[model samples]
Target: MCDFTVAVFRPDDDRLEDAVELLESLGATPVPDPMLAVEPTGASPRDDADYTILTSKTGAELVAGAYPGTDSDGVADGGARTDRWNPGEATLCAVGPKTADALRERGYDPEIVPQEYTSSGLVAALEDRVDGARVEVARSDHGSPVLLEGLEAAGAYVHETVLYRLVRPEGSGDSTELAAAGGLDVACFTSSLTVTNWLEAADERGVRDAALEGLSNATVGVIGEPTGETAVAAGIDVDLVASEATFETLATETVELAAPTYYE
Candidate 1:
């Protein structure tokens, strides 16, 4: 195993577990610090919109769980539950492949997935298609404003449903201590909220300055440019931005940057 340690701040779920396994496979010690938690609102997307968008895999799963015939893997066994909001004639869209996959698993076909996974990318993909259309966006409460504003500017009537809320988990921030102590070798931040919540965690622990100092000595990587900007705005130096906005690519590239010889 390499001597480097990589801190991953994902939600406390399969994403975090998958990150830990991926890091261990790459020979870097994984610091499994969950900075986010999901709170479902029990509100589903509107069925009557001309276009419906889902921004996260968690949102897809939460909505899918409400359906009857959508199996865990998305194979339809019986039929979609009548009690839930069916897509009807709405064209479904996902912000990225992962979210699209989640939707597919739940028996919904995502007709549009932008090459770029950001909110701006979604707007760019749909700007021409959604003019004068009613669009419903379902995702977390922390979704980017760029999506709503861009859609509205393109002549689409946009309504957003907060499928879930992302909050800092009660007992997170162990990685802040490790980072503050200069024990971290690399850190992978997946979103702007992750970056903000992490610093907030550091402040809550009274180690904000120390954590920033420690991260200076470690390689920092984010999933996209927005997240990178957030880190920079928070006085954190980001050494890498994954070419793709996915955790697998982010962790792999961050590991390679931290220990070039480790993978070889």
Candidate 2:
């Protein structure tokens, strides 16, 4: 078994568990240290139309709760008209399978999803169809600009709806976590905010060197290229990137890349 322990900074417990499972299956130990907390956006829902794009699962869940009882699937409640989402007829683009599955479970079938599962990939996939189309993006308040910008540049009338927000976890001592991270081998960053929060936490904990050294020594795995870029900018050497920008793919690649230090 590999002696190295992989550190994960995902906020969700279920996602953390999934990553841990993948690492353990490959004999690599996992240490979860979530830096950011996700919360629902207080924004009210707007009228729906032909195309609705779900960018993240959290956003989907928020919309589902806001629009309760509208769909039989119980995913979306009642904000927008359900009849507008004609499944195979209307086009719905999702950033990842999780978001796509969320839509599916809610009674809306997505027609377009990127193979790479990143904002850029999703934008690229929808560029052709988005031209001159009316598109609504359901996403977090802190979502990336790539999707919205790309769609607008492609002549699509894009309306972005905030569904959630990411903030620093309350009562979590950033400095303490960073100080403790010195013993960790790998630091996994899933989002840009995670990178920012982790740096702040490390600085607060007075373990910047430990965090930096750990990141430099061990592989820094990221879910997408944007996140990888953030790590590189923070002086963390990235070793592996998920082929598809999903937690499952991230875990899979993380285990495979760290397999040299792990046992089956």
Q: What C-alpha lDDT, on a 0 to 100 scale, does residue 178 get in candidate 1?
A: 96
| TM-score of each prediction | 0.91, 0.83
Give the runs in model 1 whose Cα sits over 4 Å from its true position. 66-84, 261-264
The weakest ten consecutive residues by lDDT in model 1 span: 75-84
List all candidate RMSDs to the true structure.
4.5, 4.6
Candidate 2 lDDT, 187-228, residue by residue in tens:
567888888888887777777667687666566678788888
- Give per-residue CA lDDT, model 1, range 1-264, as digits (tens): 576889998887788889999999988899999988876666778989999999998888877764323455443334422233588899999999999998888788999999899899999999999899999999999998999999999999999998778899998899999998889889999999999999999999999999999999999999888889999999999999999999999999988888964557
Error of 1 at 99 (Å): 0.7
